[model samples]
Each structure stands twice: as C-alpha cells, then as structure tokens.
Target: MAKYKGRILFVLAGALLIIIWDFIYYFVLQYSFNLQVDLLFGTLILFIGYYTGKNYDESNETVSAISKSEEKIKRLNEELHLVLQNITEVVFHTNSKGEFQFLNHSWEELTGYSIKESIHKNALHFISLHERHEFLRVLRRSISEQKEKTKIDFSFQTRSGQFRWGEVNIKLNYDENGELAGTVGTISDITERIHNEEELLEMNETLAIESQKLSVAGQLAAGIAHEVRNPLTSINGFLQLLRDDADEKTREYLEIVFSEIKRIELVLSELLILAKPQSVTYKRINIVETLDHVAKLLNTNAILYNIEIQTAFKQRDLYIRGDENQLKQVFINLVKNAIEAMPHGGNIMIEAGLNEYNKVELSFKDEGIGMKKQILDKLGEPFFTTKTKGTGLGLTICLRILRDHSADISVQSEQGEGTTFSIKFEAAHQQERKKREQTQKVW
Candidate 1:
C-alpha cells in the first residue's frame, strides 16, 4: 500500500507540473495546449491518490492489530516458562520415537542432566535398564489401546549413578486434526517416600512380632513356671549334695549335672524376663559410664579369646532415660557376643556417638565371622542362635530390654566380613529440646 500511495502522489505532482508548464507556454510563447486534456489528467491523478491513501490507512491498522497479537503471545510464553521452571515435578515432551524434545527445570535438578544435553536423547535413557523394557511395554499398550493417558512407576537413573523411583503420568499429544504428535509427561521423584513406606512396613512386621511375644508370654508363663521350677530346684539341691562327697570321676559327673542344672536355670530366667511384663525403671544415666562399665566387665572374656576390645566414645556426657540394669545387660550381651564371635582373636569395637536424628547410637562391631541375610533376619527370635553353646535367649533379652526403653536396634553383617550391631536410643534431653522448640513456635 505504501508503494502504491507513493506512485500515485508522484503521478499527481507530475501532472500538476505539466499543466503549469502548458499554461506558461500558451501564455508566454503563444504555444497552444489542450485544456480539456489537462483537466482529465488532473482528475484521474486525484481519484487514484484518494483510493491509495485509504488503502494505506487500512494497512497500518492491520499491522497494529498483528503487533498486539504477537505481544500477547510473547507474554503467554513467558508466563508458561515461569510456571514450568518453578514447578517441582519434572515436565517433558517426547516424540513418538521416545526422543526428548523438551524438559523442564526440575528435570535438570533431579537427573543432573541439563536441558541441552537432554534434548534429542532417548527418554528411556533416564530409566533403569531392567525397567526400560517394562516402560516400553506400557507405552505400546497405551498406544495400541489408543489410550489418551497412562501412568507407570519405574526407577530412573541419575547422572551420579544413583537410581530413584519416579512416578510418571503421560498423555498422548495430538494436533488439531486429532492425529498423534508425541507424548507429554510429568515425573515425580518418589524415592524418599518409597523408602519411608518400606520402612513403615518393616516396622509393622517388627511390631507384630512384639505383639506375639506379649500374647505368648501370658499363656506360656503360667504353665511353664509352675511345672519346671519345682523339679529343677530339687535336681539342683540333689546335685549339690552328691558333689560334696564324690571322688574325682563322680565329682566330674556331679559337676556336669550341676552345670546342666545351671543352664536350665539360665533359660528359665530369660523366659521369665520375656514372660512377665515388668515396669521399666527409667533413670537419666550417663551412657558413657554405662558402656565403659560393661566393656570393663567383659574385658576378661575378650582377653581370654585373644581379642582386643576397643572403645570409641565420640561424644561425652551422653545420657538416655532407660532402666540402668537392663541397659547395662544389653551392652554386656552385645559385647560378650562380639567377643565370642572371634574365636581366633579379632578386634571388638564399641563405639558411641550422637546421630543427626538427636539419638544416641552405640555400635558393637566384631571382626569375627559374620552372618548371612537369613540369620540376620531371624536374629531376635526365641531359640534362634548360630553358636553351638549359644542360648539364643541373650539377643532376645537384649531386644526386649531395648524395646522397653523405646530404643531401636539394627544389625548389619556380611559373611566373613564382620558384623555390626547398632542400638539407637533417644537422648535423655531430646524431649525437653522438642518441648522448647514447640514453646518457641507458640510464642
């Protein structure tokens, strides 16, 4: 329109110049010119100018409208970019061939793969190898069924060689003609939540075992206590009498009888501990002193086995609210077990420290024979022992005592690598700390 308008204005100016020249020639030089022809020429130039000027104004209005529309689109894209960047869940788009076309900010944060590196990469690259086949199967099923949306849970590998569980929700992207374009999806890292759920399930299983102990305690205690104690007492008394007047051979026999009797007594005592629900006497005791005392008491046994007992008390003045005797017994059993594990003399480390969770942790690690997964799983059960002379009641008692103190215990072992028995107790002042925090919040 501008070009047309410029051409018309030029024509109008030329026509005016020519008409003026024609008048000049006719008046000054007696040159005759056609006046009607000049009028026709001027009129035609005015009409073209008027029409072209109107068209030029319309063209300007059209350009202004298009500029406004482009500005709106620009703003929309900016807003969408902000939303995608700020969202925690990873958002992405992939072609039908499963190659990534777009990935949001969270994708980089979670997978440590920048947007530039991720583009044109296969979407399955983020998924673990074992799960990639399953992912492809799910995608195929969705496509074959013509489903608009599909959801799948799979483990995704990160740039650091760590795997995290991600839940993906995918939808088929289509054009205005309803033909398939590609897939768009969101991925949420559920690794922490998955771990928490698994921990809760394991805790529930442990709690169920504890419940069974309580239930069996009542029923078995009543029958066993009365039936076994009387006869065992009589046998112990008779054996003592016989051992006093016996010769060398007979004395040895009597001594064996006495030892067997004592073993029965020890078993009975452990049963009673489990059978009766006794109130735990809680006291704020220094955990360091308790561990030191237990280690000292077991020092002789450790020395006899040619093992060195090492203490690593990383924190001082650590305290917990628990039954002093029971807690001491727990340490004694754990340390003694560690000593016995090393028949050929190895190091026994008893370490104590405060964990990030504000819990006091004591670990008894033995450089002796370790246990397999099967034995580790059945550790706290009654009558479950790996040692030939082990009563198995020792660990059971330890577990019961720790449970009474509201503590947690975990054991890790690998065959021939050694074992670590970790017991965690809430710090004595932890509750006070929590109360102070809550009060501060209230204030």
Candidate 2:
C-alpha cells in the first residue's frame, strides 16, 4: 500500500513540475505555449514514474527472498554439523594426498586423538604397519578403476597402542574439471564384530575336529572291547585260581599281574565313556559347594605331595545348570592335574566368581612347571599326556563332560610361569530366563 501511494505521489509531483515549467515558458518568456508539446511531456513523465516504482518493488522482493534463503541454508548447515558430531562412526574428509582435511567428534572418541591435532595427518598413520600397505593398495585400485565408492576393512592402531578393526567406506570427490579433489568417508569400529566372527569360526572348526575324533574313537572302542574284554576276563579268572595255590613269591608275581589287568580295565572304561557319554540329568547346582567338595576330597592328596589346595569364591550361592556328579568329576580331574603339575610343592588356587558377562567363572591356577606352546596345543586330544604313566584320557573325558554342561574353557600358560584353566558357564538364573523367553515365544 505504501509503495502504491509513493508511486501516486511521484506521478502528481511530475505533473505539477511539468505544468509549472509550461507556465514559466508561456508567461515569463512571453512565448506561445504548444498544447501538443505540454501533453506529450506530461504523458512521458507519468510513464517514467510508473516504470521506476515497479522496478523498486521487484528489487525489494528479490532482496527479501535472498535473505530468507541464506537463513535457511545456515540452519541446515548447523543441523548437519550436529548429526556429524554425535554419530558413533567417524565421518571424515581427506585431500587427494590422503591427508585428513576434516574429522568429526567420533574420530577423537575412537582414536583418542584431538580433532585439532589429527587434522592434516596422513590416514595411513593410524593403520597397523602390516595392514597399511594393503589399505593403500586397495584405495589406489579403486581410484584407478574409476570407482565412485569403495570399502575396506583393516586393523588400525589406537592412542593406547592397541590395534582394533575398522571398516572404512570411502566416496571419491572431484573438482569441476573432473580431476581428483579428495575423498569423504566413514570409519566404523568393527573390532567386537570381527572378534566374534573369528571366535565362531574357530569354534566350528574345533567342533568338526572333535566330531571326527569321537567317531574314530567310538569305532575303535567298540572293536577293542569286543575282542579284548572276554579274553582278559578268562585270563584273570584263571590267574586268581592259580594264585590261591601258589607259593609266596608266585603270589607276589600274581598280585602285580592283577594290578596291570586292573589298569587295562580302567583305560577301557574311559574309552567307552569317550565313545558314548552317559545321559546327564541337569539341575541348578551350587557351583561354590561343588568346588569346595572337590577341594576337600583332594586336600589330603595335595598335602602328601607337599602342595596346598586353596579355595576362594566371590559369592557363596553362585549356581549353574549342570549334572552334579559330572561337574564334580571335572573339578576333581582339574585339581588333580594341578597337584601333579607341581612336583616340588606349590599352591593350587581354585577360584569361583561371576564374570563381567554375568556368567559363572571358575579357574584353577597352579604354580608349577608350565607347558610349552606345542604341548599346550595338543591338550584334549585322546592319548596325549606329559606324565610318564598317564593314559591322557583324563583331560579328554573332563573336556567332554564340561561340553555336555555347556561350559567354555580356556587355558593360559607360559613356560616357567605356571598355568591357569578358566571355565565359564551360564548362570542358573540366566539359563532359566532364557528358557522362559523361549517358552513365551512358543506361546
């Protein structure tokens, strides 16, 4: 409305000026005024005024629109920055030379390096030395192939000197002339995922190997028991009959023969167990009590060997789902092994507690002659042992029993430093909760 009024006033002013000029030309100059010229000048002045006002209004509108557009752009930029700052993955930009040009807050969180300090640093600097070459090779290959985007997984060094897995996704950028400008990308922390995949793969391989071994052992055990048991039984019966009528020296020889036969019987029994494990009745059993019982049962044996058996529990009522007798047998075997490892006298530390994952963790640590890597790797194999008279089936049987109870075992040892066997089991409460969830799902 104001603009219209201004345009009207401009026209009126222009007409008034033109009329005053006409009067001055007619009266002051004493000349005849031409009506046609006056009318032409008035019309031209009106047209000029209207044209100027129309352009002024359009100019104002253009400026207002520009201001609004600038404000919107600024707001969008701020939102983009906020998203980049809070995301868990590191978003970054680099120059053609692979020098970092920009990095979001997540880079600092992942690498422990300040954004200010990390700028202009080479991307390869953070990668592990062994993996840097491969990283660069893949990046160059993608560029050479004229690929717009690429992904690579590599191990990168963190600020604390630890290497972690990172999956990098890169998008290439170019200048107006289509020449390479730089690259924008994201780095995701995939360390946990990678470790989990590796563990799963290792477990699958181990299960396959174990299955094959069990199959062979089963066939062997069946054949050996069928062919050897009857003859051994007949020979033992005749030997006992002959021993009752023999002299003192002959009786002593007969007793040794009886002991050898008994040892053979024990081996056969263990083989059978390995071939076909007995059916187990799993129940919620207190792990603390089981460990305590095993410790007490072996306490006298440890004492005679100049060894001390110690027990520690973080919680008194820690429980797990397992067969009680089988679990006790497993613990006994581990404790006995610990006692045997230390010939000169040492401490056998048995500890039970809840781990970070809320699983029941039980460990047997012994201060003794620890094994070399090659020997440790062979553990759990049938007929593998370090002891002079060991049949090597003890640990194999213990491993099978623990597997039946759904336990995970790990061994850590260093020559001259001693060994620790750690076992983890799902807590009884957790097991019950999982069952309930499955039941709910079924319903």
Candidate 3:
C-alpha cells in the first residue's frame, strides 16, 4: 500500500474481497452449504486464478520489449561492419591510451593484421621507423592543443615493410564535458601524388640545363669565328697585292680565288651573327627617321627594277627604346623580302602608326605572289628557303631578333593577290617614360 502504483489497486481488491466473502458466507454459503469450512476453499480458488493471470501477462510484455531491443542492436552492428569493409584506405578508432578500439577491414588488409592483433597496438607502431619522429611531433602537438581535427601527410610502413605516403585526417572525440576521450581518423595513400610532384620538379630542372647548353654552343661558335677574322684579313690583303702585280690572264684567275675567299668570309660572318648573343642596348630612336633612311637606301634598287616603292607614316615623331642595329635588321629583312617577292615591279607599301596602347604598328604590303599555309609555318625555321642562291638565314635571324625584343609580328596573304606583314611594339613603357620624364628619355 505504500507504493502508489500498486497500492491503490491492491486496496480496492481487498475491500471487494471482504464484502463478497461476507455476503457469500452469511447468505448463500451459510444457508446452502451445510459445511461452514467450504468458504476457505472458494476464496483460495478465486485469488490464485486472478493473481496468476495478471503476473503471466506482465512477464510476457517485458520479455517482448527486451527481444526487440536486442534485434535493433544487431542490425546496426552489421551495417557498421559492411560500411567499414567497403573503403579502400585504412580506418580506425582509438582510446586515449592509444589502443585500437575499432577498425575497418581495410586496416587489417593494409597492415596484415587480424582484428585481434590490431586492437592491442596503437597507430604509431604501424608507421615506418624512419618517419616515426616526425609523426610523433605532429601527434604530440595535436593532443597538446586538444585539436578537434588534424590533417597530416606522412609515410607509413605497410605489411610488406615498404614505405608508403599517406594523407591522414583525424578528429578528436570528446565527452559531454568537452574533455578529450579518443580519436577517429581515415588514412589515404598519397604515394603516387607525391611521386608525380617530384617528377615535375625534375623536368623543370632539366629545361634550365638545356638552355645553358644552347648558350654555351653559341659562345663557342662566336669565339671560333672571331679567331678566323685575323687570318681572313691577311689572305685578302695578299690576294689584292697579287692581282695588282699580275697580267690580265693570271689576274683573272687570282680574282676568282679572291672572290671565293670573300664568299667564305661572308659565311663566317653569318655564323658569327648566329652564334654571338646580343646584349640589350636600348636607345631612343625615331621610327619615322629610321624607316625614311632604309627606304632611301632601297629607293635606288626600286627604281633600277622599275618597282613602285612608297611610304605612309604618322605626322608626329614616333620613337622607341630598342637596339638600333637589331631593329634596323628586322625592318630591312621585311622590306627586302617584300621587294624580292614582287619580281615584276609591283607595289611595295610601308605603313607606320601608333596603336591604342601607345604601341607602334608597322606594316609592309607587297603586290607579290602569296605563300601557302605550310610554307608560312616553317618561315622562321633556320635553313628553310624558296629563293635560289639565298642563304635562308635572313628570316630566321629576324625571328630570333624579334623574339629577343619581345616584339610581335603577323603576316596576311592571298594567293595571286598580295602579301602584308605587320609588327606591333608595345609603347606603354615609352609612354610612362614620357609622362614621368624618366632621365633615360634622351637616349
């Protein structure tokens, strides 16, 4: 009766029992039953049947609830096991003591350990011996600050005792009070990624080496050509003296020898130009004046060949900062090629203007037979030529010079119509020098 839940029902039952028993004993049982002792047997039978039925129902319900709870737990455990088995990389959970408490099947496969072996050892034991010190440093730092998560790249020793790089991500587990409890993490093999990075680094290093080799080859050739100049001058002087002393018949033969030597010297000079590296010597040169001078030199040839040569330039002075000789060479090659292409005295137009970015834009147009796409692609490759008795070095040298100056060039042409060549030089830096009145402007 002291217990509230059971007390109320038990008290009600007792009150009913007393009233019913008295009624049965005094009225029906007392009169009908000749024996007074039959009351105890009737009451005992009713009490036993009622208590037994209630107890049985309550016990059955308790058993059913327990069975359902155990079934749910089993289902969840199986799902977790399947998930752990599917991953390719390793996965594990550990307590603060560094003992493995849980692991995926990958952990066993990667480390060659059965579940029994892994549960006793910490992750530190699985790492490569050489990388242990570094890993220990990272682990200690992570735990000291109570870091909730950590990502680290390190080497791990596999079951076969080979080193493999891994990218590990670990999260700290905490209790309700935010106290550190343990850690759970995933480890991914990054051995291939690391190897690729190293390979790329090696390739870049090789490119630098190739560039240096090309430079050395150029220097050696230039030195050899310079040495030949002295010998070449002596030979030319003797040939001239011999021609002066001889008769016409023998002189003609000497002249031929001299001409051949001169041709050899010219070849030497071309090689020197190719091998000698250019030093950047910038000076302020008027583009209009340079073009005017070049046109005048070629003007005679234009007339001799009955060609129409014309120039259209901007009114204002357009100056640029560049090597005088190299820039002149580029223009001369363009103009000469234009003239050569137009064999039948066609028009050669040279145009110059400034672009929006304050860059100089120059174009050479010629009424000549245009080239095909295949020829255009190989135009700047050394030793490629269509002209008979041509050295084939002119355009190749032009390409190198322009590339060195960081200038731009483009060509447009149509078959049987004409050809046009364009050059664009950035003048923004020149504009800045003009605006700021840089002291180097005079040059």
Candidate 4:
C-alpha cells in the first residue's frame, strides 16, 4: 500500500476523527464533548474545506482560458466572411473530388448565378468545352506535384451562356495534419484585356500597311512622271515636225502621234483612279455585263500572251450593288494577273453564279505557275509582289474596293498546282446587304 501525501492524510484524518467523535458522543460519552476535543475537530474541518476550494479555483481558470480562445476564433471567421463578400474577383475552394466547397460573393456577381445554385456543383461546369482539357491538365499536375501555386488562362461560361476569358491562380490546399484537403483558386475576368490586345495588334498591322503604301506611292510618283513625259515629248516633237514640213511622211507621223496620245491618256486615267479618293456611287450592277466588258477590254492583252479567256455563267442576271467602273477595274486587274502568271500560255477560266450561301460567287482560276506560301501570305501588302516587273498594287487596290462594297475575297494556291481567286458579293434581291450592315455596325 502506498503512503498518503500531506493533504490526503489531513483529509482522511479529519474524516476519521469526526466519525469517532460522533460515536463517542452518542454511545460512549453520553451527549457531551469536551472543549479541547471540539477545537481540534474544528481546525481539521477548516483545512479540508480549504483544499476543496483550491481544486475548484484551478478548474475555473482552465475554463476561462478556453472561452477566450473560442471568442477569438469566432471573430476571425466573421472577418474572413466579410472580406470574401466584398472582394471584386472570384474566390473559390473545392474538395479533393473537384466539387465546389465555397464560392465567394464575387463569383455570384460575375457569373450572375447565386451561391445557392452553384454550391456543390462540379468546378468544371463553368469551364468552356474547348478549355476543359487544358484546365484539367493543369489542375491535375498541380495537385499531383503538390505545387504551391500555378496560373492558367481559360474561357469561363456565365450563367446567361456567354463565354468570357479568365485567368486563374490556383493553390493546392492541405489540412493541419498535412493530408490533401482540396484546392483554392482566384479568377479574374480577362475578356476586355484580351480584346484590347488584339485591337492593338490589328492597329499595328494597319500602320505597317499604310507605311508600305506611302513608300510605294513615292516610287510610283517618279515612275509616273518619267513614263508620262516620254509619251508627251514624242507627241510634241512629231506635231512640231509636221508644222514645219508637210509631206508623204506626215500621215504616218500623225498616226504615231495619235497612238502616243492614247497611251498617255490610259496611263493618266489609271493613276488618277488609284491616287485620287473618289466617293462611292452605288448602282445595281449586272454581273454578266461587267464580265463581258472586262473580257473585251483585256482580249488584246490576252491574245498577245497566247492565253485564252474562258467565261461561264450559271446565272446570267446575277446582280449586286457597286460602282460599275470600279467593278470593271477589279476584273481587269485579276485577268491581267492571270495572263501574267502563265508565261507559257494557258486558259483563264472566269465563272459567276449564286453560291450555296445565296451570295454571288465570282472566281478567276489560272493554269499558271502557282505562288508559294510566303508570297501568297503577303498578297495584299503594298509593294510586295512576286513578278519581275510587277507594281504590286493591283491586288491591294482590289482588296480595298472589295471591302468598300461589303464583299469578301479568298485566294487558294498551291505551288506548281495553280491558283484561284474567289470573290463573294451579297445578292441584290436578298436582304443580305442590310444584314451585313447591321452586323458590321456600319453607320
């Protein structure tokens, strides 16, 4: 048996003495206790009472500490909730199973869906289909490697079915015991930022195109002056000679002068069309008539190269709204290009019809040495040409005219196989022009 400690002994001795005093007073001592005995019992009882009170005080102290800790935790939780509610970007957490555990107020505001509707949903539900694979790959890699943080860009669909670009920063979560808990991520809407970046890129490209045009214009200016001066000088010298002396040679000289004047007039007209900005004059144009006129005009040029121009019209009366002269210019440039492509001489096929889209489809297919990818890519850039003596502005001017008419053009070429230039215009009978204007936000 173990020996009792001082406090235990005091308690036990006090209890035992009380029992003995009770027995002696009731049976042996017959109703009376001495004063000395009573004093001693009273002191023992006071010591035992003091020991009991001390134990209770120690228990109360421990309870008070625990209550204070609980109050601090409650305050911290309230502060976190307030912060999540007011933040502008999405804050979210998910379980290991990829189900959403919590979505902050920002999620509701950005996606236009209430928290009650999104709770416990799969996190992938908001990801766009095309971006889901990438999102999953990044997420799995982060979780598997226990990455502290990772970033990804993806498209997120809103409650109203609009997909917007988003960039998310993800962090893997763990419990206090270092076990896998889930993931927490923050998402920011990047749609407008991406759009602005694209706009800047397009603006830069346009600036580059304009700079090339200016350089080409400067070169053309000198060439035009030289080319025009020669023809004019020839006509002037011939007329002066005719005035000084009239003879049998005068008739031949007169013919030469007239031909020189015609050539100069043609050069000046082409230069004026390109250099001067003219207001668009809209009229209903017959596609067949325009094609015929262009073929007749380029017939002599084609015959010189031994290349034949073949025309086929599935619909004779196809109509579109555009400037007739500009349309004629477009075809002339295209046919001339076709003729130039085939140095060995080949057939140039021109076709016009209503395509499946109910738009007028006009195509120029050439059986010539096709263009390589590098040259084809820079087709519309000013001064970028593949020909040995080409001005390179023919295709650029065609593209500009097509855009002004709300038309579309495409080129398909394979090196050594041949090339095709396809142009599509809205049909006059259909309401396509109106629809195009509305979609393009044309004033």
lDDT of 3 by residue, 180-239 (tens): 688888988799999999999998897566446546645755886878888989988988
TM-score of candidate 4 versus the correct structure, residues matched by position: 0.46
Give the Å error, residue 304, model 2: 1.8
Candidate 2: global Cα-lDDT?
0.90
Would you estimate the TM-scores of all the predictions? 0.60, 0.64, 0.46, 0.46
CA error at residue 248 for candidate 2, angstroms? 6.2
Give the lDDT of residue 29 in candidate 1.
Answer: 83
lDDT agreement with native, every candidate? 0.84, 0.90, 0.77, 0.81
Let me know the TM-score candidate 1 reaches against the reference structure.
0.60
In angstroms, the error of model 1 at 185 is: 11
lDDT of 4 by residue, 1-443 (tens): 11224346556666777778778786886977577877777676858754864565556667778999999999999999999889989999989777889999999877888998888999888888888998889877776777778999888888898878889988888777665688888999899999999999999999777767755774675578667767787767878777577676886777787676666655555554556676879888898889988887888889899988889999889999899888887899899888888989989899999999999999999999999889887887755778765656667778778878989999999876779999999988775567687889965
Best by TM-score: 2
Off by over 4 Å in 1: 1-58, 61-68, 71-210, 217-219, 239-252, 435-443
- Order the candidate numbers by lDDT, best to worst: 2, 1, 4, 3
Clashing pairs in 2: none
Q: Which candidate do you rate higher for lDDT, 1 or 3?
A: 1
